[model samples]
Target chain A: MSAVDTRVPQPTTPTPPSPRRMGPDARRVTARTVRYTLLFLFLVFVLIPVYVLLVTSFKPGTEATLTGAWDLPQNWTLDAWREAWDALSPSLWRSFAIAIPASIVSAILGSMNGFVFSRWRFPGSDIVFTLFLFGMFIPYQAVMIPLRQLTSDLGLASGVPTLIVVHIAYGIPICSLIFRGYYSTTIPNELVEAGRVDGAGLIRTYALIVLPLSAPGFVVTLIWQFTSVWNDFLFAIFLSNTRNGPVTIALNALAGGQLTDYAASMAGALIASFPTLIVYIVLGRWFIGGLMAGSLKT
Target chain B: MRSRIRNWGPGLLMVAPSIVVIAVFVYVLIGATVNESLTDRHTAAPAENYVGLENYANLLDDDRFIHSLKNLAVLTVVFVTGTLVLGVLWAFLLEKGVKGEGFFRSAYLFPMAVSFVASGVVWRWLLNSAEGEGAGGLNALFGMAGLDVLQNPWWSHPDWGMAAMAVPAIWQLSGYVMALFLAGFRGIPNELREAARVDGASEAQLYRHVLFPQLSPVALTALIIIGHMSMKMFDLIMAVSGAQYLTEVPAVYMWQALLTNDYAKAAAIAIVLLVVVAVLVVPYLIHNARTERQR
Candidate 1:
């Protein structure tokens, strides 16, 4: 009798089949229709510009400017893509050269830092961590002058190596924050205690226990660092010369040149964005999770 | 003492590299910048003597610097509010259960994956405000629809130029804000709504009483993050408009000052930007650390 009573009270059940329900039913339907309509309109507004960019990239140069922005190309061509590749391939390589070393070094350093801060308790540790946290919010412009002097003084005035060093040095704060947040939440101190009880040293415990549990955090930090370092323009422009510039600066120059080729510029934009776009599409859920983890909760 | 040394030594050693690197790159650099800003160094050399508050005072008299500040204020107001409104609306729509939730969600965030430089490239072309038959971008869309009156110069117009830049910004980040809000909505337990429904609460009443109040933290997070991004905005304006006076921001001015070897002024501008960002971010960090402790 109790089960029957509990199961019978679903909200989806008909409300006594009343005739008075007709007015509310119509109103509910109207409201739902309005909601759907508004959502669809907003979707259209969000996507139209992206659609324009994609279609414009496909159009030949003349058609892109001559026809209406909304008009589809009569015939697609790969000439623009080919030209963009030829023009941007060197800087694309440079971006990778700068981004890869930077990501790996920072990830390793950050993982170590995170372990110490999260698992190891010491006097003044919280203050030290807070000091590091401050770096996450310091605008890069503030450090530009000193950074230039430091790089030049070290005989790395303008090149991939300088760019690499700059990125790794600056990437520490955010990377440390991400890793610390991840470890403190998911890897409890009990596990570390277990490893230590087995007579394992600090490095051994980290390598044996924590690292195995840290693959996801590593992926998150890697993706974040790779995208950030790859997309960076200010540091690229400030730290390196035009000859060894990253893809972003080169693309900017290409698009902002005296005679702007609409088709080629659009094509270059698409090409330059394709790498990060692929990462986003493939790992977007985890990427979003990482972003939320870094901001929320703390 | 020996055991304590063994214990503390390893942990400190593991963290030492990051500490040294960040100390050099962040703290030491900040110290150097503050020193540079207070001096009369015009070239790449070290400061000769201190000139207290001279650079900041000069900035007060500088029209271009004042214009940049004004533009920053406009961008911050418009970008922050626009992103919040649109993002919250989108989140509400998604929360109600849309058909293509995954597709729309990904599509919305796709812009964020791309660099601002690339967005600037496409938007620069899209917002080209050529007159007559040469019209392009949104202006071209207007021309096609025969709404000639709607055609306005974007990023080129004297007034509202920075407002135009805010469009690309909102487009890139509104989806991020939406994701933030959607997470908030999902975090609310269904039992709360069920109880409200059992109490015969209307949908509007349920939202007003339950959902809105719970979403306040998410709103604060969004505000702080967006405020920080807007204040430090550089690459987008640089890519879209170059160094045009109409669209010059403090970051751009700082870059230009460096090019002309005006180290003091550049350092001053950088310090100003840093102070603005610190004011917004410090309170949030303190709150975050405190809450983490309670947790």
Candidate 2:
């Protein structure tokens, strides 16, 4: 979830003549320290909730009552973690069963659309692409009514299918945008023309040339889509009955309006948070880097 | 005729898959929703009678809907601004090469990957009332230490809870924004910074005058991304208020409508959300489209 800070490669790509250097202002030292102090305070402010979440997850219900929030746990136990897992495992899987396929399907179709838009220019191509672009503008509420009815009609009601469709349809617009943008940059015109000259038709060229080049972008888009769909709670709750709902629905379920299951709630939360943490530790830089470089190619 | 067929050939093969999928699942479904808003039909089947925007009229007057919409407006403002400011500042700090860069980056980014449901649950414990989740961790420690302000009803108080709701969202989002800004910051020429130093500009002045302008495009990019995110912000809110059957964001509101046999009203809310998104999304998407065409 770290926002990848990427700007245009203006300084590095285009060689510039050497220029004279400037030195840091010695007179501004005290002022700089004050500014730095303010920045650190803000950083601490931002970090407070995280500290709260981590500490609360560790504290026994009684310790939670007795100790202050900022202190390290006096009696930390794995019990909350155990409880959260037992309570939320089913919901997490239900979410994944829906989100994973929905993202894959969206990525597959979106990739194909991107390839076409990037390679062959057709009569209605721009208009259709425009419609897909327009799709990104649409809010979930606008489509919820018809979608709920449609879900029931298809006999996909109250389970993974309903959630899957919600995610897939929503997934298409952004995925296609990223894919198409990536293709337009990485897949050169010369390569495609050369493929055409070799008598390789459209599908053949995609299978051989374009798809391979676009793999990085596709993987990047997949990760992004997976996170979004997995995190979403609206459709899973609305379209599906509780049996097939995601972790979000279950977590919310812990709170019966006024009352909440504190220990069970924190445990369920910790388990649900695992996927994104794993992604950051493993695929962190590439995901954000690929997204910015690919998107900013525009 | 032969030429005409050939011209259409690649289009059919290449574009048809995308078109069919989108049309069946998205475009047509959206069209169906627009139709539903004109009727008050409920229960298992859509009656498809013209109720002449009666649903829209009733929605305009509905207390809960109005309240949610007002709350939604407040939410959008806070969410978009909160994420952007903190996100950009974080991106700056990460980019500027402070100590423990990697550790801090990971610490900040961890919240994002975990499910909001999970994060929401954790935050509830953090914010819940003394009678609710108790002063527990921070409150107990801070309270005993005489930091009494920390013991306030942080989450139970409605306005404060809303801000508290934003805390996790901002936490999850800021790291990503920081990464984006860091990327953009690295893109700037070293000479620019050096030249500012030679000109005797303060670091603050240098950032204000030099780095900030160059980062505008990157900032713009972050703005649009955060806007879409804030628009779809249901999970955090749902977790905060308990769930759809209770707290009602536009998305949750729509969901509840379907659950309670108010399909038309649900569709109306959904459509209204889509329209609001369009106001933000269309321009940015178009800008992206144009930028891509240039590239």
Candidate 3:
């Protein structure tokens, strides 16, 4: 469980050098060099596309050709950025509109469910929790046909609101799973017992005692939900369109269309990725923690 | 019993919303899809008749569906294996304590933040199949390095296009694998390694004999996660290949069917996908539940 807290690897105290069994100084240096060299090469392999994206995004139209994709921009300009923003800004806002509220609602719902399932367990709670967890693993396509039908039947299709509701519905499993894991591990039974001894019921214990301690859980779930919702393409494409789709749909349109504005497409990709990228960078530790927590139960 | 009900009532009520959502959206909707698959609801019309196993039967002879399944098999195997291998290697490297591990880890992971659609756009460019002077993206880089032999049609290859698509998939997910393996590495007790060291285990032997066995659980988890993701892969293919038959998988095929108002066929495909995933995931979920209970 402590392994789950994979933040930055802490530097450990160095073991005293033993030249007898382990090789001498030169051999160790060479090994270290080889390791660093391999890491650098992998680093390069990983960043190649990123390099292309950044350089291509900054290039003017004439210089942004695929043949010169690896080149730095000769005429570095913001035109592509402006063009991408013009095309994608509305959808960007729509993504925020979907992700912000969806994340908040799901996080709240998850917190309550987590509290009940973890602390206030009823008989068969484990089975129910397992059932809920199964929902997280389902292929959305299996439910897509009916989900679309249901949404349309309710007059909720092709809109941000529909996407939000859909996201929340689908989000329940992972969000609650994270919060449930968080509450069970971090929030001790004694606190719940203490609250119960003080006449705090489930709702009251959650609001007064549990909720305050839930900031970490909320952070993880919110970031996780917000990223998934923001990055969602399948739901965005199915439930909405060019008129009101999220950034993913718009980015797909911008890049997938016949007239390939290479610079604008690259910029659009970067733009679509900006919010989640920011979330990942800023709340990276918790983001990774949430990721592990959602997947690995223990 | 009255006191038990009293104690259970609020807890039940608290979790009711989640249960309802999962019931309606997941379980009930799956049931509805199964029902839809069994009926003859081809068009957008409300007319539906019981067709029993006709759609599934049709798929048995459907070449496109079979080809899509093959593509899925190639993609899943390549994607899952590539991600696992790279993930373990990088995790092992990081665990060995490199300089600026934080920067390397984040750089490796930043792609996880980028959407598949967005990354697909760039990869489509990177995987451009042109040759000679027209070579661009990775091809151009290969040409520059005088590795012209390595430069070939990537995702556009007729035989192994799906494998090429797995390249981007691996790029996006291997970082996640690395993080998981790193965690697995961290979780192991130090004394075990020290004991193995004292027994004259070489560094390679230490990892091969001592470390790799303990990381099997993490590897299985990674395999399942990557496997399920590969099964559900739609957006990446759609973004990269644009419904090209060369890279088409079941999810994309289902979407194409839905677009043509072939509800029954789409539902059948979706049900097949659901069954496949359930077969893969349910046992793991059950095992996870039993383990957690024992703990």
The lDDT of model 1 is 0.84
Summarize candidate 1's per-residue lDDT along A1-298 as a digit string, tens digits: 0111221222333333555664665545555556778877877777776787788888888887734678888889987788888888999999999989999889888888888889975556677788888887788999999898899888885879899999999888778888888899888999888876776889998998899999988898888888889999989888876589899988998888898777788888888988888999999987786677656453
Off by over 4 Å in 3: A1-22, A197-199
Query: Is candidate 2 or 3 superior in lDDT?
Result: 3
Tell me the tens digit of each residue's lDDT in model 1 across B54-169. Answer: 99999999999999999898888989999999899888877756567788888777777889998898777667768568887788777877999988887788878788889889
Comparing 1 and 3 on lDDT, the stronger one:
3
Q: Chain A vs. true chain A, TM-score per candidate? A: 0.87, 0.83, 0.90
Off by over 4 Å in 2: A1-76, A155-157, A255-259, A290-298, B1-8, B42-48, B129-164, B189-205, B243-248
For candidate 2, write residues B1-295 as lDDT tens digits.
8866664477568778667767777788888888877785777675768898888888888888876676566666777788778777677656655445676666666566766666666565555557324556445545666777656655355553455556667777776677777778888888888888899997689889998999988888877777777777777776755544224567777767776887778778878788777788777767866775575
- Please list the C-alpha lDDT of all candidates, in the order they appear: 0.84, 0.69, 0.89
What CA RMSD would candidate 1 show?
4.2
lDDT of 2 at B222: 76
List TM-scores for all candidates, in order: 0.92, 0.84, 0.95
